[model samples]
Target: MLTNAPSVAPVPTASAPVPTDSAPVSQLAVADALMSLLRDTTTEPRPDIQLEALTLAVSADLPVL
Candidate 1:
């Protein structure tokens, strides 16, 4: 089967972007990020890293700070 479809990475949705603000202290957002950082991935989110995330979220008006 010959196909002309060149596979390419999918684009991110509107909600998804490089966080430029602090993360909201909402129960959900932090929980989701925490899960993504801690259990599911090898990357353990350091406090410093979290702080940076918080900064971005704040910048984005995420109400995290």
Candidate 2:
């Protein structure tokens, strides 16, 4: 069946600035975005072990496995 359907397009608002390829992003902004994304993801139940490993690796100036 052929029916007329209205197409929807996202209307950009003035409050939010759209990022462009040429736009320069700050390190803090990138880190914040990454942290925000990771915050919503599932993690191991024993986070303490993972945290301890990361802490020890950083303290020894060694790469995290």
Candidate 3:
């Protein structure tokens, strides 16, 4: 059974792209990438990793979207 888990803080990465105000197109790209990651179960088997990836993805794009 699925249970609600506490949100995890995003892992810091040096390579994470800095969000910019000038790019609306990249917002779609970020959303698409997030969807792709969520759909690919084989690449992200652990739920924690999935959650972290999702959190990072959304938070990164939230400012613009």
lDDT of 3 at 28: 46
Best by TM-score: 2
The lDDT of each candidate is: 0.52, 0.59, 0.52
Per-residue C-alpha lDDT of model 1 across residues 1-65, encoded as one tens digit per residue:
34886643222223343343483234344445555546545667557888788889988888763
Can you write out model 2's per-residue Cα lDDT over 1-65, one digit (the tens) per residue?
A: 34685532222333323446786455445556556657769967665887898999999999877
RMSD of 3: 22.5
Task: Enumerate residue pairs that collide in model 2.
Answer: none
TM-score of each: 0.24, 0.32, 0.26
Ranking by lDDT: 2, 1, 3
Better of 1 and 2 by TM-score: 2
What's the true lDDT of residue 53 in model 3? 74
Candidate 2 minimal-lDDT segment of 10 residues: 8-17
